[model samples]
Target: MADRETPGDAARSDRRPLDGIVVLDITRVVAGPFCAMLLADLGASVIKVEHPDDPDYARGFPPMVGGGDAGESAFFTQFNRNKRGISVNLKSPDGKELLKQLVRKADVLVENFRPGTMDKLGLGYDELRRCNPRLVYTAISGFGRTGPNSSRPAFDNTGQAVGGLWSMNGYADRPPVRVGTIIGDLAASLYATIGTLAALRTAEKTGEGQVVDVSQQDSILTLTENAVVRYTTRGEVASPLGNDHPFVRPYGQFPCKDGYVFFGGYTDKFWRLTCEMFGEPEVADDPEIDTMDKRFDPDVAERRVKPLLERWFSAYGKAELEAMAGDRVPLSAIKTIPEVVEDPHVAARNMIVEVPVGGETVRMVGSPIKLSMTGEIPLGAAPAPGQHTRSVLAELLGLDDEAIRRLAGSGAI
Candidate 1:
């Protein structure tokens, strides 16, 4: 995949692997926008298509770049970076025909509408494939294209609740909490990106494109891990452990003098090292919990290991404890948002990037996918509504100024 070539590789204007590919992003909010942004970062020419009059609601998301309601959404700016923007009235006949025209030249089309909305507009995958046989049709939905719940409109929290993720998140006694982040949308977006690239590869190889259906609920269900397997294999309905692992002892977050530190001294070797680091080497030789298997017993863990670790951990600060543990025990300070943004390790990895927007700079998390050839992905400011409509229409569809003016007049651009 890293070496795959496309039409304009001879010029090598963009050294990224996805150069010469074009993507039509017919999506809003999180999941779909994130998928398209990944493609854009990889050097694909992504055109974000929103409704002309009522554009993506994310444009109003707050903490606006220039402050108040005067400027663009910083939230929108982060996800939509490195993409051109267009607006189309998909409800109109002219808009439908215009989208079809753009489809013929596009390598991929990504949409996050409800199951049948595209079909109602007559721009569904079945219809679009007729316009371009090699176009990858990527769809992200709540439950999926085929299911009893397929038609339901879902947001991030909805996906988490329905997919059983919310039930497993918090302490067993307390009401469950949704994952701190928008894992439902983000996980689905990651899966959609993987599916799109795979389908794109098949399109290039066999000259045939296919549908990529990613459901947020399905994505969440896939991440349930040991809970699902435990139920199936042992009929054990897992309950929340409140930062505790199912089998490992001394492996969860512990309070230090200031802030918290995650400590993993479960393995016998690491446990011994941790004991030595605390100047309690005799504790490591305790016959009652000498081996890792013995330490897993509830009685031993509850009465012995937990108290020992907690007593030691409470005496030192997070950074001091982590430094003492070093590479011997897997220990690290739990960082806050500000701490993470200023982290030396994150800076060294180029994980945080700044994008210039409307004379202001919005700092954003950078793409994690790094290729040796494409060392750094250039960030483009998030576009105003329909900002690139005329350019995209003229370049891709070969529409002249008169035609562009007519489309704009009809509110179909």
Candidate 2:
């Protein structure tokens, strides 16, 4: 805790890639916060704008710093790291003017409110572009800003169900299941981040800013990739095949003595190697099962090859199976979360980092992007609500103490 740099201190440093850029983050919860946090990690000065009376609801979410009702949420802290915070009641006239002032100096602005919410408040992209023509304005929502369902409220599950992900997940016999993680919201955030960066580049070059409209459904649909192509071209509907691959035999998870191990023997060479490793060389040599197409046949794979490999795998432990197959076969043991956190590779790559929170240290997932020139990005603590209201107003808006006091008295800070 003592060694970690504060967000303000980090923002003052010059070595970051987005060092001089200022981001006005008027978003709450996962999708929007995740996107802004990435920019912050890359060295942007991100200012999280919250309501004067009610801040981001995630601030009170579970897994708090202390084991009480009043503690700060670690979940919120993890996503909002490396950002300053300010509170402003946008419904108030003073607050609106304050935001407009901030917009004049900001390089980027991000929000995830449903379509028309910002427009009603006079803070939409069309309006803000007038303040700063070079501002990169991004909006993330469930269905995007120009669709029939643009105003429909959605969360992670809604995106998964509407985008066809739930239909293709889980076992064929079971009900459709949402993925374990909030991939819907997270994926939209990732796509929005990419769109924002690209828009920023264009804005910098042409001195013109544009709106980046990102939809959770659209982002999830893009991940369907080959499934959509296969359905449209072959008139085939994909169903959950458990861990099995649709086009290859012996390309799924196998139950070992202790746990499950994934083996992808998709290529002919790997198929033969897997057979040899499983002590079933005869299966590899048989003319009926030699080629990929023959081995991929449902009846052949299910009744003949699968049973033999299952029996062989059931006799060995996961580690023994991995060692036997070695690098020749694409074998992996399905590790749990704790195992992954303690893994040697993860440590070496710095994928787990410790940050200060509430006078203590908490570990969170680190950024994956590595830059040669910028080096390691600093991870800073998330700020308290309106923590920098006075300082930011003075520094950016050139407001004196009297002005700041007046704004605060009027409930507009």
Question: Against the true structure, whose TM-score is highest?
Answer: 1
lDDT value, residue 148 of candidate 2: 92
RMSD of 2: 4.9
Tell me the tens digit of each residue's lDDT in model 2 across 276-395: 887777778888778888888999888877887789889998878878878788988788888789988799778989987766789889999866555678889998999998888899
Score candidate 1 by TM-score against the native: 0.95
Which sections of candidate 1 miss by over 4 Å? 1-14
Cα RMSD, each candidate: 4.3, 4.9
TM-score of each: 0.95, 0.93
Q: Which residue pairs in model 2 clash with each other?
A: none
Model 1 residue 139 lDDT?
Answer: 96
* Residue range 1-413, candidate 1, lDDT tens digits: 59566454455444788999999999999999999999999999999998988999999987677765558888998889999999999999899999999999999999999999999999999999999999999999999999899999999998898888888888978988889999999999999999999999999999999999999999999988788888999998766678888888868888889988898889999989988999999998999989999999888998998888889999999879878987778999999999899998899778899997656987889989866545478898988899999999999988999999999898787
